[model samples]
Target: MIQRIQSLYLTLTGIIGIICGLITDFIPNERIDMILLLVVAILAFISIFCFKNRSAQKNINYLNIIINLLLIGFMVYYLLITPGGDLSPKKGVELIVPVLLIILLAMANKYINKDEKLIKSVDRFR
Candidate 1:
């Protein structure tokens, strides 16, 4: 599983998610965003081990994408609704993490699909 490119991607995604959650303070005095990001990280970590279950892996990635999307949406909404909330460089940088995670998860899903296709093609020869 560790040898697969998707596994590596998933691992990286999870690590980055965790790091972002721990290091970045996106919202003052609110742990909601941090909690959500950590959840995504944990899901990615667990999905990495489901190499034998392509369907489950794909579904988990889809779910991960949705969570990331929601995270992005929440961030945007918070920024828009809060008074005196400006897109300073520091706060703006925090927004990028979810986008990066979304991209990584999509890439991992693409590779997982490719692997699934390859396995199917090889099995047809039997």
Candidate 2:
């Protein structure tokens, strides 16, 4: 699995997701965003081991993408509704983390799909 590009992408996604959780202070006394990120990180990490199950890994990546999108939406909503004095441009940059993760997950999915197609093509020769 380590030899596959998707595995590397997935690993990076998990690591960065966790880092985003630790450093981003989107809200005071509330860690919903962090918790959501942690969940995604864990999902990505576990999916990496299932190299033999492309469909399941694809589904997990899809779920991770959706969750990351939802997390982005929720963060934006929270930032918009809260009082202006508490937020700044630097804080808004935290949204980039999810965006990056989305891109990485999409790339990983692309590679996974390629592998699936290759496996299918090979099986057709039997």
Candidate 3:
């Protein structure tokens, strides 16, 4: 059940991130917000790729974490320092996709780590 949930989460996130990217493509790009979304889309794709190396999923987790942080940082920079600054809080829909991707990446990594640990423990017992 846990493994299924994790896989589902990762898959869902990847799908959503891709959809978000496509949606963002329609919005007019003025201040490079799309850059952060691109980072998110890349990381989301990486999350799916990590499935091949379930053992090295830990390392992939680390990489994904770093990417997520970079995405967040760029988003923050756009919001606080950039000239226009993030769109109106209540009306800002662009922020949703990247932020959702960040949360999904973090959660997916955590789930992968837990799954790895469980498998390792089972191996030890065997």
Number of the top-ranking candidate, with lDDT as the measure:
2
lDDT of each: 0.85, 0.86, 0.59
lDDT of each residue in 23-44, candidate 1, tens digit only? 7555432477888889999999
Q: TM-scores of all models?
A: 0.90, 0.89, 0.63
What's the number of clashes in each of the models? 0, 0, 0
Ranking of candidates on TM-score, top first: 1, 2, 3
Better of 1 and 2 by lDDT: 2
lDDT of 3 by residue, 24-102 (tens): 5433443354554555556555656567576565565556556656655656555565455365443334556556665
Taking every candidate in turn, the Cα RMSD to the unseen true structure, in Å, is 2.1, 2.0, 4.2
Tens-digit lDDT string for candidate 2 (1-126): 668999999999999978877765543224788888899899999889988899999999999999999888988887677665643544476678889999999999999999999999999999
Which ranking of candidates, highest lDDT first?
Answer: 2, 1, 3
Candidate 3 — worst ten consecutive residues by lDDT sum? Answer: 25-34
Q: Which stretches of candidate 3 lie over 4 Å from their true place?
A: 1-3, 25-32, 81-93
Candidate 3 Cα lDDT to native = 0.59
| TM-score of candidate 3 against the unseen true structure | 0.63
